[model samples]
Target: MTASLPVAPDARQKPVIAVVGPTGTGKSDLAIALAQRLGGECINADSMQFYRGMDIGTAKLAEDEMGGVPHHLLDILDVTDEASVAVFQRQARELFDEVRARGNYPILVGGSGLYVRAALDHLEFPDTDPAVRARLEAELQERGRGVLHARLAELDPASAQRVNDDRRLVRALEVIEVTGRPFSSFMPVRQYVQPAIQIGLNGPRELLHERLHQRVVKMAEVGLLNEVAELETRGLRQGKTASRAIGYREFLKVLDSQRGVLQEEYSVADAITDTVVATRQFARRQITWFSADERVRWIDFTDPASLSHALRAVTDA
Candidate 1:
């Protein structure tokens, strides 16, 4: 089948099919089913789902849910391990190469827009300095996020514009600590790394919001609380990066509420409701993140014909 993909100099590097969209858009289902049909293997591009023991809350697919299709990059990390985009990009490329070596199509699937973009663009990022990061983190804790963000705006307007207020401020401060240079100065020009057939599944905002709500409800039904309980029992704290994953952090607040800690008078039910709302907000941010990339071929997901149309484009090339 001809895949309508960007041209690559070598046929040895197999073409990729990236299934991307907001959370609860059925991207994983489509990618797995497609892999089953087309001799493909799926690789995760999600940031949060990598953590072990986070299955129910992260909406990570179970082994049976995978429908016997081989998958990569899921449950490969501990909660304490920090997974960076550069590291993910490198491992994802290796997985892509391995999949192609086996003569199978590589299907990349997730809602993490940054990870997807990093993989597609072959982005090169600067090395991280632990001492620098530690100092910046300490400063942020003491000085506040607004102060750091203001500093970033002065030093690197372009990077500041692209990143979220929280992450940009933290990273900008780290860069200043490390090199005494602005974070914007290290930005690399992107180079396309693969011949990829892109397909986006997007619906109206209301529909997406509803879907996100329903997905959260499903998570609750399927033992999300138990998952959080296990993590808490393992001594995962709210301040840690892994504990700060959307679901984990919110549920931790719920636990604290039980202990009379939250001053906002949150309860278990309130926590659940707020978590669902926050997840919807996260999906909105994901949409904004993906929209910034011009190379993706977008499709309105409500149309039943959209997937077929995208597949046709993939095969027509």
Candidate 2:
């Protein structure tokens, strides 16, 4: 049983609540508060936070921080496991329905824009061929991400512009090949599969940049290096997805330096800087993704009145 009083499935219809935006924008905090106010549970959408032993890097909140609200789909994978949006959509919807059936609000929270859409929208993913994917990945390594991105732009400019990661770029091209159409054709429409209220939390660009830098520094100061070190022993190096996560990847470079594997030593300072830059680029990508959807009610969540505004938005929706 949850700390909040449970409702019967037929008690009333409550829209699923989604709190989204860039990192360091307090979306998680807002989601928890909204869940408490609405007597709901949370479903995590941040892709990197799904691994069991990746607490520090992914910024997984402590149990005490959760404030007795039940959270689902966290720590459900190992460092070696790859996250599949198709599978996540299936599992997340199942858990979301269960929460609604129990008469509690199912709050969706994360910085991963696509994952959130996949959970709440009618988004479909195409199947992949290992042989085709392997060839694309090899070309990505040899020709660099820019070459693949340029090829994609020529074939599917809409999808090409939205991609910021090499893996995603490769995947988009693969999808175009497999489906014989532009990858953007498979994009989510501005409609929810379930009744839902989407709220985006953001702040001034300069402030968010500073906060992201501080967050990276804090992560480094608070054993982020050690955490990455531990995960390296757990096959993080071999995990295609987990190994490429922002903090984990940067710190792995530091690890190599510590072992004297590189001629020039990589410093903690270097890792922090790299992380900050990567995070800022990632935040820009996230904001762009959400901005494309007219349905999200954007709010400056750092302001004192945001709670009232959010309450009004959710209640009215």
- TM-score quality measure for candidate 2: 0.83
Candidate 2 residues 82-130, lDDT tens each? 9999988988887776787777888999989879989999998887877
Candidate 1 per-residue C-alpha lDDT over 1-317 given as tens digits, one digit per residue, 9 for 90 to 100: 12233333453456788988788788888888678767889999998888888898888998989999999999877777777888888888777777776777889999888798788785557666888777777888899877777777787787678768565567666776677776777764455686787777788888888878777778777877778888887655742557878777877787787778878766657767888888888888878877876767788777877757667756864
How does model 2 fare in lDDT?
0.88
What's the TM-score of each model vs. the native? 0.81, 0.83
- Over 4 Å off, model 2: 1-12, 129-185
Which numbered prediction scores highest in lDDT against the true structure? Answer: 2
Worst 10-residue lDDT window for candidate 1 reads 1-10
lDDT of each: 0.77, 0.88
Per-model root-mean-square deviation over C-alphas: 5.4, 5.0
What is candidate 1's TM-score against the reference? 0.81
